[model samples]
Target: MMCLKTMMVCSLRQQILPILGLLLIIECIISLKLLELRVPSHVPLGTRAELSCSWQLGEHDVLYSVKWYKDGREFFRHVPRDLEPRRKFPLPGVDVETFDTSGGNVTLSPAVLETGGRYRCEVSGERPLFPTVSDHADMLVVVLPDHGPMISGFRSRYRTGDRVQVNCTSGRSRPATQLAWYINGEPAPASAVQSAIDKKTEDLETTSMALDFVVQETDFKKNGLKIKCLATLAPVYWRSNEESALKEKAISNQLLRSSLEDVKVTRADRVLANSAEFTNSWRHVVLLLCSMPNLFLRGLVWFPFFLQEI
Candidate 1:
């Protein structure tokens, strides 16, 4: 009886070990996982954009379907078992060009401004296991400006105590560009910055800002006074325009006149000193000539010419 019991125990142990090994293998081989979800954070409007979703399936698992959703609404579907593996549903602002099954990549031609939103990619395994994995990311469709900010209402020059008022305008965009003012590389004072104005044209927007301040003597630097307008669209576009201003001509002319007066005064003083010296030398010569009688008469011939010159 003891020998029979030992054989039965060995048989049970052999069966249990094989069952446990098979379970471990099944667990290891059956899995559906999301590897990567590629969505652009910013896409330029009216341009093509490609989004990719990659996944991994274990040896025993089979890919059932891959679905893409925009703002929680299904837009694209791919099922390997179907006669047509790829299908696209109509969704506003989502223009599906092609869906590549080999790598599960989706392409959108001429993405519009309304295409900006949260996107999700979901992957599922074939029946029996039915494992699912998903991931999501946000995308923005941006309308970039064709050019930098433009400055207007600028004067040829500004002087101390003069009021300066100017406007900065940005190119048309989907979302209006934000504008800021800088004076001499520093942020303009809040008191000097006016409110931003927005203009809309057929779904595109343009923004402008005004800057007003009184010119001060301290505003001028070695490079002259600089006024800059900065335009930005968050996380994507940044541009600026700058203008330089000099002191008014009146002030410059006054300084130039003062310099000229100083030069004139110096020249007059030098001339007077030279004339006094020449007169004294001539008087000494006249006295010496008077001492010599014969030379005195000859000196008189040149005296009239010399007096005329004097």
Candidate 2:
């Protein structure tokens, strides 16, 4: 009985081993996998965008078809066995210029604002199994500004306690650009930033934001303050404009004028002191002459006697 039990266990092990080996072989034979899908995260409007899909297949498998989808709807298809290997279906904002069947690449000329969405690529193997592999990525069609942000309404100089009112405007874009203000290399406080304004013209949009704050002593760095306006169009565009304002010199000029006046007063005091000293010396000379009256009388008598002897 023990021998029979041992034989039954051996039979079961043999059956399972063969089934597992067969399954491994089948898995190795059916290898259709997507390697990579290249989709640009951001594409500028009115420019060409190229998307690529790459895959790998087993030695025995052949590629059956490759399809591209936008927002879950198929837009392009390629079948090597068909009479027309490349075909495009109509999709809004999707313009298929050329399709490369060999490399699974699709090119879109002049991408528009509506072209931004989820993109997917599907690849299938030929014949019996028809194994399919797929991948997806998101894209955004952007309208970038032609220039950097513009700053206005800023004074060339500012003083402590003076109100500063300035506006930053971004160039036209698809979605309004985001604007930010930085004072002396730091982000401005929420209270300093006013409500943002958006101006739309046709399909493009422009953004403007105002900054209003009182100049503080701490805002000055090295006798100047830096004001910067940063504009961004998410994931793609970034630009900034900066202006430097000098600290007002009114106080310093006043101090300088006071110092000059003090110097002038000191000079005048010195001149007056010299004049008083000179007057005192002249008074002493007059008193000495008055004290020498007898000498003057002797000189007069001697002058008469000397004149008679001559």
Candidate 3:
């Protein structure tokens, strides 16, 4: 009886060991995998963006559901058991469309500047056996400017006492560009600048700034004064425009020479007498000669080219 009982116990142990091994094998084989989630390295504002997710599972394993999240908010879902395989939740400022729920792909048409952030994708299988698997990827949306900011209202000519008006205008920008002016390689005073929203289209806006100041004689000398307009969209984009003041010193000198020639000596004998007697006429001539340096005409040269900023 003892021998028979020992043999029965061995048989039961063998059966239990095989069943446990089979269960382990089945558990190893049933797996839901989230292989990868793809997002663009750079996505410009007001342009299209594509996001994809790849998953794998065993032949017998079923894909119960898939989900997409942005910054912790679930915006897309796919359930194979439901009649509608794909569904999208409205996320303000994010224009999202799911192209394929089974394939795990979506598109964002004309992405907004504020829509860039962390993204996550999740895949689920049979709940009690195969659990949910998830993967994450970061998408840093880049907001690119529509075009370079432009500098306008700077003329090619100006008198010394004239008020110089320079305008900086930016193309359609989402956050409304910031503009600043620099004169003679220095930032222009705030009192001399006036900014406004020049134009708008839908959600985008254009920014403009006008700088007004009196032209000074020093602005025309040597290398010619430089005026610059700077536009900023924070860390995303920085653009600028540079202009040079046009100096016509030779023309002014020619005009002075012509004036001197036109002032003919109506009374040669009287001019000689005044010259010999050290009269006020001689002092007037000396004063006129001293004032020649201050008569320079300072103007501006408009550049046709616009530079790119990254």
- Residues 152-207, candidate 2, lDDT per residue (tens digit)? 99999999999999999999997789999999999999999998999999888899
Query: 190, model 1: CA deviation in Å?
Result: 3.4
Model 3 spans with C-alpha error above 4 angstroms: 1-43, 46-68, 75-145, 218-223, 250-310
Clashing pairs in 3: none
Task: Output the TM-score of candidate 2.
Answer: 0.69
lDDT of 1 by residue, 46-88 (tens): 8887889998888778888999999999999988889988888
Name the weakest run of 10 consecutive residues (lDDT summed) in model 1. 24-33
Q: Give the Cα lDDT of each candidate.
A: 0.87, 0.90, 0.75
How much does candidate 1 score in TM-score? 0.64
Give the worst 10-residue stretch by lDDT in candidate 2: 21-30
TM-score of each: 0.64, 0.69, 0.44
The digit string of per-residue lDDT tens for model 3 on 1-310 reads: 9999999999999999999978865664455667788987556677777889998886667788888888889888889888987888877656575477484888876777667878888888865565677888776555456788788787776656667887888878666778888888889888888856558777677888888998778665563667898888765678998888665443578888877766765467678887878877788888887777445322112222222221
Better of 2 and 3 by lDDT: 2
What pairs collide in candidate 2? none
User: What's the lDDT for residue 235 in model 2?
Assistant: 75
